[model samples]
Target: MSATTATARPTRNIESLTERAAALLGGTPDDETLRRYLNGLSGVDAVGLEARAADLGTRSIKTTSKVWALDKIVELIDLTTLEGADTPGKVRSLVAKALNPDASDQSCPRVAAVCVYGDMVPIAIEALGSAHGDPDDGGVSVAAVATAFPSGRASLAVKLADTADAVSNGADEIDMVIDRGAFLSGRYGVVFEQITQVKAACVRADGTSASLKVILETGELNTYDNIKRASWLAILAGGDFIKTSTGKVQPAATLPVTLLMLEVVRDWYRATGEKIGVKPAGGIRTSKDAIKHVVTVAETAGEEWLQPHLFRFGASSLLNDVLRQRQKISTGHYTGADYVTID
Candidate 1:
């Protein structure tokens, strides 16, 4: 699609999310469709999907588009640091890096947000400073991974408190994991309500709700059919974005899985007149891989998803790689990883 077409796209047709849910549920508050709508869905054609994603991965992006993609990639990074070794000092460094990814080039854009464990939210918030303030001057939001993080095994109350603690600590966004066990065991209703409850718990210090990105952990789900169902379920349950994996799981964030996610988001926008964001975390490391994912978003979901608000990459090393590519593009030589600051 042309850049003009992507940028000039009009606002999506949307009413309140509640109304959208009601419509999806066919106006019945206790409708069985809420529980069984995703059941019996056709299984994914894995071979075909992988083949298609492979074909798209070969697209040659050059010069202007390459530069644009690199800049955009910088903005889409989540700049994550979720290790057990995380410290206040580590979080501060990550926040600084997120606010200014490249000190040498003033044109380089800041990252979208800094993702960390719930306890580190305060450190990141303090380092970011007035997150709701002016963006051009310097504004980077903090995203806390809540709901038992990589696994959603805790009790409902615990999960709710986990979400509440992060928001109270000044998180602007919440990335939550779904109950994969419930989803796999045919308890769709349980999974659906879990997401709604977590979303409700994202209310910020000022009472405004934080944006919620539902992590489906597509790696565990194992099929495009499951990914598709999970994506729709998250959207119907008030998720602002549908994320791929937690990056802790094996085989996290493959292109075929991400392609299905983009398709689901695009189709959902067509159905509900509201756009939901897509984030593919885990296993995406290089600038080429990053741009390939960008291509998938543009082609599958339309250029509207290309914006930072609608797209993100949950990664730790992705920022450095993009920066290195930026340096290469400018000076006509590759700078080793030693040159870029590690996040």
Candidate 2:
């Protein structure tokens, strides 16, 4: 797609974000404007934030509710395989697993999407076949990690090319990593411009835009305050979803971090009447942990955020554990590992 067309796309306009920022900042979204708005954010009470997250984790649900949570977890998972060794065959297998998480039970819900490297988008789409469609419509979507994923160290041209290629190859969603260096150094405008450009690159041939999930790499940001700032910056840049990490960091998705990100989304929705999705990727490995996140989402962002379009779990192993838990719920006993397909 031409740059003119990409920039002209109303859905990915940078002004949409700047206008919102302007309303909040009382001026255009320049470096000073961003700094003022971001720095003006309320300080996060680390102890209180951690305590609340822990308290939310301790909340429990009934058996019937557990069953529902398990299914919802399965449905919200972005079955991911972002490895150097990933091949077309591996992507196809992942797509198959996403289409049918449980082979024995036809009633088992399919995952929300299959996330792979940008180059593997076609492989996933081909494998998904008829089941490849919008995630909101119960069809599995293909999500590709773009913008030099895991480490946003590339030039702007390369990043935009990476994103454009993925969208042209039929990726329904693009997960992009922000330039943490710029963000950390207080060059918020650079990060904001990059996110807007990447969102523009997500425009497909049909005039529709692929959803953009901006990865904050919260682990690298170092403090709760910075994480909150990055979350707000990402939302202000028109990211459809604000993601926690790339699953390659030391401390991927923590409860406090995810909760903080959800709070950002919650506040943004309340102020603008627009809903933004949140995906807490990495390190979330079990049904129990996923349920805690579910509870956190409900309590922070409300029940409306539980759907695939509104929330997602960027996980691979987490799905297997959820499948086991789901089987136990249906059979009154836990099934062995061999029951679910290994990714």
Candidate 3:
């Protein structure tokens, strides 16, 4: 696609990809169509991905795009470690990091929302201070991954309880994974039910609502069409953010997947006027990659998606790279590893 053509897509400039795909096949697309699309696709047959690419290219309004919503993005960036912090030292380290994210030599996002397993919320709460204590200087507002996470094998009641407990412990966001197996089985309704119920469980410690982000596990879903369909469902089901992967999956997040997601968000925005966020997590260990995602956001969703808001790279190891790059850009030399400290 020509750069000019790519950058020209507005609400009407682009075609409805899913609907187009359905029309291409001469049938309405349902969860089964999504499943079939994910099961196979080659460069020769990937018209959907091609269309999305073309549409993204033509998008203008760069700065006004939703990806630039850093205030929104920063709040949703969930600094997570699903392996669990098994010791007091680890919890203390997490606390210290939350309070002093700059210790990593990279200034943390303005509000480094902590994402711990349900077990660590109390420690995070005390360490950061009631996320509810003050609007400022408090610890991170916790986000807990629920719906059994990664494996996603659990009863509906159990998953709902997991979400409720996370919110009860002061978590501000619910990051839940869709049941990949069920989704793959062409059971989108089940996936929808899962996210809807869990989203309902999100509430603040003060008894308010916590935002919901639905993890698509894109690597496993394996196709742009499927990713788009899943993105639609999550947002329609109340996902505040549509994430790439769990950071547990191989090729966790990729430029291609992120690009597809940006298109999904843009289309979603045009349809509902409700802008949802996009997070590309897993396997992102460098600042350059983060910057590239930033650029993708800039180009795809426009400048509005540039900051942490509509765009975020989920990485335990990426902050340092951003810092290093910033420092390198700021100063003239490679100051070496000695310049930064990690707790």
Pairs of residues at least 3 apart in sequence or in different chains that clash in candidate 1: none
TM-score of each: 0.88, 0.93, 0.73
- For candidate 2, write residues 1-343 as lDDT tens digits: 2222222213445556767767877886678889999999999999999999999998857766777888999999999999999989888889889988999888989998899998898888778877777666677888899999989999999999999998887788899999999999999989988998898898776677888999999999999999999999888888989999999997999999999999999999898898999999999998888999999999999999999888999998998898887777678552433232211
Error of 2 at 160 (Å): 0.5
Clashes of each: 0, 0, 20
lDDT of 3 by residue, 65-179 (tens): 2223322333334566678536555765765654555554444344446667876766666666533222123235556688888778899999998888877766656678989
lDDT (Cα, tens digit) per residue for candidate 1, span 1-343: 1111111212222235557677767753232666556664566788988998999988876566778889988888889999999999999999888877889998998887888999998787777665432222345667889999888899999999999988777676789999999888767778877887788787544445677889999989867888888888888888888999899997898899899889888888787677888999999998888988998999899987877678999999988888988887789553432232211
Sorting all predicted structures by lDDT, with the top scorer first, yields 2, 1, 3
Model 3 TM-score, 2 decimals: 0.73
Selected candidate, larger lDDT, 2 vs 3: 2
| lDDT (Cα atoms) of all candidates against the true structure | 0.79, 0.86, 0.61
| Candidate 1 C-alpha error for residue 258, in Å | 0.8
Each prediction's RMSD over C-alphas, in Å, is 6.3, 4.8, 10.3
**TM-score-based ranking, best first?**
2, 1, 3
